[model samples]
Target: MTATQAKPRQPDLKTSLPGPKTAEIMARDQATLSTSYMRPYPFVPDFGKGVWLTDVDGNTMLDFFAGIAVSTTGHAHPHVVQAVQRQIEKFTHVCLTDYPQEITTSLAERLVKHVERPGEKWRVFFSNSGAEAVEAAVKLARNHTGRQHIISTMGSFHGRTYGAITLTGSKTKYKRGFGPLLPAVSHVPYPNPFRPPLGSTPENCGQAVIDHIESLFVGILPADEVAAIIVEPMQGEGGYIVPPADFLPGLRALCDKHGIMLIFDEVQAGMGRTGKMFSFQHFDVQPDIITSAKGIASGMPLGALLAKESVMTWPVGSHGSTYGGNPVAAAASHATLDLLEGQVKHEGCGDSLMDNAAQVGDFILGELKGMQDEFPFIGDVRGRGLFIGIEFVKPDGSPDGALRDQASMMMFEKGLLNLDCGEAVIRISPPLILTREEAATGLDIMRGVFQELK
Candidate 1:
């Protein structure tokens, strides 16, 4: 099948969702699995191919969520699967740090090359997940600057680990009851054009955020003590928020002025999700460090901390991971990158998958905006590339979390897989390889849900 072609057999729902087999598996899952996992609807998957998922009972569903944007090349891309299979057959383990592997080194080289900047050399440190990448970046920033304080934006979701969760400011639930978090971390408001704070306009929101950071420096934290300022180019969990155009550039200037490292947490927005190899590429400014993982290896467990070589001054034993750059995962990553960069193009598809993201994402955004005009609950529609979000709000313009939840569940019941983020925002982060027809199908389901909810 061509990259842009929709599955010939679309969403064949034979039985009610959570059919007999699904119910049986779910019953066993509830008994054995941890309650921490949030399964919004009982759509248990037996297998997936491309943008389609098959439940245990043979019900087919469209996967617009892409496993939370981890499946960059789409589910079970032949290239990635073949690469993993070949690598595993050779040998999967042999901790890279303890015993160097060529595949891991090769993948790191490619990642460094992808982020290369003139007069600035980059190096990659592998980890097992986005949180680990964040942790590594934080440690490296501290070690390089010899400073303790770190800054993150409000409405940001870094990760769930202690240091990562400490940096997250999107929701208190993630931080609640896990207090005494890594100290010296502070959160400043992130610029949101749609719901500007203090009634700031899009033109001034960036400046307002900078002014707030300046105030913090003077009143609370000393600028010299701040080691780094981490942010997402396009906020993900904090509601696929796209900051004002000037926000990132202004933040970069501020970080430079304070001699602070600027870290871009592209775990959710990177790896071709935003029509670029990295989301920060959308802005002219460059960050000192980048944490990437999701979609890096088309759903494989891998994370990377890409940093300027000069800033990664910590000694050898300072950090290491046993499974950070498994050969199998690295092989898969190489294949994933191949498809993303268009080195290996499927028949009749565009040169690169990122190009597809731009085209289809614009189409999806246009449709959502058109729908917003008709639906009062769609208070806002914003995003870049495929990483879009639709905010639900009451008539008074207050966030309507309940309505958002209801709509999301309704979409699931209709055989469309989606996810909610922030307080009342529904995020649409499908695989980068998504086609226009597939996107329209998902949006149609959303429209039906919105109509019913209204």
Candidate 2:
């Protein structure tokens, strides 16, 4: 061990999972909240600072999932807290659609710089969540192209809203019994490298998906009538499935050839999660429209749709949101960008958060890769930056979701918080502010739990 490196702190557990206070809260929550809400573990968190959360019962634990990858700057990061506080004191809401506001405009301008192409002007539409952004993009695509057919890859999760759910192909449960999904929406093959579609090689998986779409165009879905092809640059809920390097570029070419708008749903992978401002940047592909939400406001609800000026053909009053661009959320987003861009450095952060994500993600990925030989259930490890996936498989090389579920609960009991994606992948998408020592600690805990399971 390096003598200069500080030892990571350990978790403080004074009680069991769902301690007395937490159990009480859960009971009340079940009675009061929607029955649809899902909680993988019973955690009644009352406080959070940086990469740790303290529950109502005073037990403290390390957070590795960051509230399903929503807390970008970390919990209650002072810069974000202060920015939100200042914004709250100034004003909370006035609605951006009807009112011209400075903070909202400023956030939009800053985000535009990150999304716009070299010679193309760009514009933004704000919403309260990622699903709204996807909905907005769909409307814009159809409105601009005057087409009915929209294509999305299977194993994709847009959101729960009508149009977004219709585009979501990850789980039928998301669309279950919701009769009459949006019409003319088609689902095609996703280029999942780990489990390639249509018996295509990992290298050709993406092309197989492209070919499947071409076949569709010649058959039922006409190429001329397609409005947009919405897909995640790297699939999130469908597994942190990073497609082959050729996928996004190929999709771009196809979209260009057919005059179809290409939409990159970056809700879970954007805002520095993948070591880039946008996940699509890694593939060197420019989407006609980009939908973002999860990490944009650092836990505050904020979503955005960025599109080429020419493509955002819908005129004003065509779509509007009463509380889309809340000033407080805009302020929080600016603070998040500041931390992410290295405009404001938190303690122990040597560089930008994006750099931190890359470095720590690389460190963890290397450790996990090394462990694969000794741990056969560690079937595959893949991701870009911190958006990682650890696939748990049986001896027969099939996904072992049961083992994953057990390991997730075990990790929770051991005071490490992570969540599963797809059927069996545990995603280690921690807040970008996580430090090296914390990363090492998380790895230690994970290794111990995995060893126990093995």
Candidate 3:
């Protein structure tokens, strides 16, 4: 059923946030779970359905984070669940390297076709996570170009693996203590319309970034040594920053001028997250390689590195994954594509989901913009579709991370689930199937929280 048709339910707090059961579970988690996992608040979920999550205390809270944007079709979507169930009934794993699976081949074919490059042909490599997809893309780029250096934008998050972390420029915290990182990787500024560098206006920030890269080519790094330039069309973990319209096209032109391959790390922004199959579609520029994962399989462990046919020239055994193409995950991905593209017969499904993302996202952005007028703490509001970020700042215009954290905690107490990114920004990335009513409910709760916090 479509999200709109589904029964609308608001937050139902039966007990205080993180009641007895939740607190007990969290205590156990503290004792057993790894300390590395960051828990902003005590939101121990017992179950989730559609855009609503029920914590162990039986409080139903509106889900705006979507498991950090992993649950593309909402929690336990029937189509995805059924597909996985069917696949498991037959066999679970055969190791893609040793045995062939039609489900894997089918998913690859569908992804290539959906990428919509017109005359260009593309190939796919399966992996288990976004980091693995990035690692695969890096390998392909280096192997194809026979070059040693790679360039990435500052404030971009690729992944946490050794190679992927080396390419990531979002935060030093992600790279701290992991010294002697992979060499030959450099970072440049990404165009931020709200805070442009080099005294650049939004209209010219795109060119400013390109100019910096050009300077790099002439000064320290030679263009010939750079194999690839990896970027997020919409920066995610760094902040949901959307560059100027000309930014991506300018990068494409720069890549064409040199022989460097352009790679888009779409792990957080792809698979209809931004009202498009891929975030780059909004810019009308295509990349040589695209890495996808987070929402591709509706919470299943699946990722893919798609590349132009000519760029995927690595020989056999150069790279392979034992559990990359697990049948259940592939099946879940196929089902996800069907739902995302509106192949299902349900009303308000498929392509309508993307449309909803755009419409509802605009509504939320408008509401927040309106709020900014009353509350100067809101520094900026920017995003495309459902992938959005709201920056908080002090009176002097410096980042107000403490205020942001306080607001988030307050919102959590009020039964809204969201997350923070960058220095002081709240990221709102709901599931693709989120309806306008659901979004409005969450926005209303946020409005109340803002009023209280302000």
lDDT of each: 0.90, 0.92, 0.89
Stretches of candidate 3 above 4 Å error?
1-8, 345-351
Give the 10-residue window scoring lowest on summed lDDT in candidate 1. 5-14
lDDT winner between candidates 1 and 3: 1
Winner by TM-score: 2
Per-residue CA lDDT of model 1 for 391-442, tens digit only, reads 9999999999999999998998898888999899999999887888778788
Runs of candidate 1 exceeding 4 Å displacement: 1-9
Best by lDDT: 2
Error of 1 at 428 (Å): 0.5
Clashes of 2: 0
lDDT value for candidate 3?
0.89
> How many residue-pair clashes does candidate 1 contain?
0
Candidate 2: segments with Cα more than 4 A from true spot: 1-6
After aligning candidate 2 to the native by TM-score, how far in Å is the CA of 219 from where it should be? 1.4
